[model samples]
Target chain A: MASNTQDAAHGAAESAPGMPQLDFSTFGNQIFWLAIALVAIYLILSRVALPRIAAVLAERQGTITNDLAAAEDLKAKAVEAEDAYNKALADARAEAQRIAAETRAEIQVGLDEAIAKADEQIAAKAAESEKAIGEIKAGALESVKVVAADTAEALVTALGGKADAKAVAAAVADRMKG
Target chain B: MEGDIAQLGQFIGAGLAAIGSGAAAIGVGHVAGNFLAGALRNPSAAAGQTATLFIGIAFAEALGIFSFLVALLLMFAV
Candidate 1:
């Protein structure tokens, strides 16, 4: 194994090229190329891509924040609108109740006046009827007295006796007293 | 026949170096897997950690690339 390795080593040493990465001869060139590549990439990213991405990110953040604030404002406005609506509803209800009470009072006043007027009319009609009845009774009594005097005088004349008018009147007056 | 031993050793060394690539791949997988686990656990925080996830992945992948470069050097330049 040692002989074989020595022979392999001798063969490899005969050739000039070995691990090219380790070759000091090309290090300067590799470093120069690497520097150029790094600078080019840095310039492209800094000048173009990075700034645009940053601007876009900043704009997106701003938009999100503004949207949140707008939503909050709208929420507050909604609450305010609800409160106003409630207040208006309460006011309308109260006004409606007041109007209803006022109308009820008006109706009550009108009803009371109507009843009083009807009672006064009824009482007046009753009094007038009572006066008329009393007059009719007085007229009937006077007629009955005159009729009795005539009937008594006619009976006495038919019987062939004198019938004094004053006497007949006195007798009728006594019967009426009973 | 005389130089075959040296060539064999170089091939063997390149093969060994290539194993590092698989190890690096495992490291990259670990980074991605952990990031996914964390992201799934707290999805709300996932968006903010995306840059960190990518940085982890890039570092793991860079190691794998370095291993591959070493394998290539062993095979061709050594």
Candidate 2:
């Protein structure tokens, strides 16, 4: 059997003119196997692997879109928050300004009232002082007149002249009138 | 022998065809490297450009596969 196989192999090597792949006898087998493998691969890819890959790709795309949408939503929320914060800050400033203005107005009113009250007290005190000065002056004038009459009567009697009380009183009265 | 010389020629031709496949590999590398560089620079646009990158790779790989086919044809068919 080995010798026969060797002879057959030797005959094949002598008869074959070119590469084995070009041999017409094996062409059908090679072509058949190649077609089968190619078709099988095509079927597996189209029916199974490709659809799975496409599903994964779609899922990835959906995830990316969702993430982008979420990011956009977050950004809008942040912008709204910033706007609200700014509005609140502005409102707080306005309120503070209003309070400051109100406080300033109240202080101004109180200052004006205090100044008016002080002025009224000063005017009353000045009037009271003026009336006291007028009374002191009138009392001083009456005492001076009485002392002058008594001095004139004493002088007339000491001079050894006719010292009549009625006459001295009349003379002192006329001098005091002038 | 003439047959021995022909077989040597076929092998040598196949080896030479392999060089073309190697050159196609360099082209594929260039395409892929450039795509990676561009993608890294603009990550936000990377998704939009991924299909184009894959197409470029496939075209470059097709040339390599053609060279491989030529090598196989040289070694076996012709």
Candidate 3:
């Protein structure tokens, strides 16, 4: 087995090959150095550089997200303020309308009371005048009846007839009724 | 005469290997040019792709270095 392996390697080990890279004698040395360099680079990058970069990127992302959330919060507050202002304005308008309505109602009540008092005075005055006219007519009729009774008694005596006071009153009252 | 022919062949192979360096330079330029075009189209995304751009440049440059090493080996060691 050893002789067969030596024979297979004879072309590479007989002398220096056309290229140093193809020389089997240096292959292990080159591979060892390459592996060492690769391991060193990997250790430096993974242990020190990559973690720091990742942390910085994460922090930046967090800052951006916080700023966006703050902006959204401020916008919501602004909308709330606008809604409050509109509600206050509507309430003020409603209050003003209610006040105007109350004032109108109060004025109307006062005017109605004043008009009713005036109408009552006018009605009372009319009733007083009618009562006075009725009293005056009654007094005039009484005076006329007295005068008529006296005139009839005088005419009966002047005609040479016996004048009866009671009869003369009865005749005057009956003629007045007609 | 045999040594002379081998030396001639090595010189020719070394000259041919040098052409790979130029090809690698073209590949690097193509990668960089496409990256610039994309970056110009969307400047906002340019910063994020910078690492990728560097990786592509390094890979293309490595090929050029490899070709240069091959040419040197042919000229000196072979």
- Note the Cα lDDT for every prediction shown: 0.86, 0.81, 0.85
DockQ of each: 0.24, 0.19, 0.10
| lDDT string, candidate 3, A1-178, tens digits | 4454344245434566745566788999999999999999999999998999999999999999999999999999999999999999999999999999999999999989999999999999989988998898998888898898888888888999888989988888899999
Q: If the candidates were sorted by their TM-score against the true structure, best first, what order would they fall in?
A: 1, 2, 3
The C-alpha local distance difference test score for the whole of candidate 1 amounts to 0.86
Alpha carbon lDDT of residue A29, candidate 1?
94
Error of 1 at B71 (Å): 1.8
List of clashing residue pairs for candidate 3: A18-B78
Quick one: best TM-score, which candidate? 1
Model 2 accuracy (lDDT, Cα) = 0.81
**TM-score of chain B as predicted in candidate 1:** 0.89
Candidate 2 structure quality by residue, lDDT tens digits, A1-178: 5455345345556757335645788889898999999999999999999999999999999999999999999999999999999999999999999999999999999999999999899888888888787788777766666676567667776786666777766776687678
Chain A vs. native, model 2, TM-score:
0.58
Question: CA lDDT of A44 in candidate 1?
Answer: 96
Residue-level lDDT of model 1, residues A16-87, one tens digit each, is 445555667888999999999999999999999999999999999999999999999999999999999999
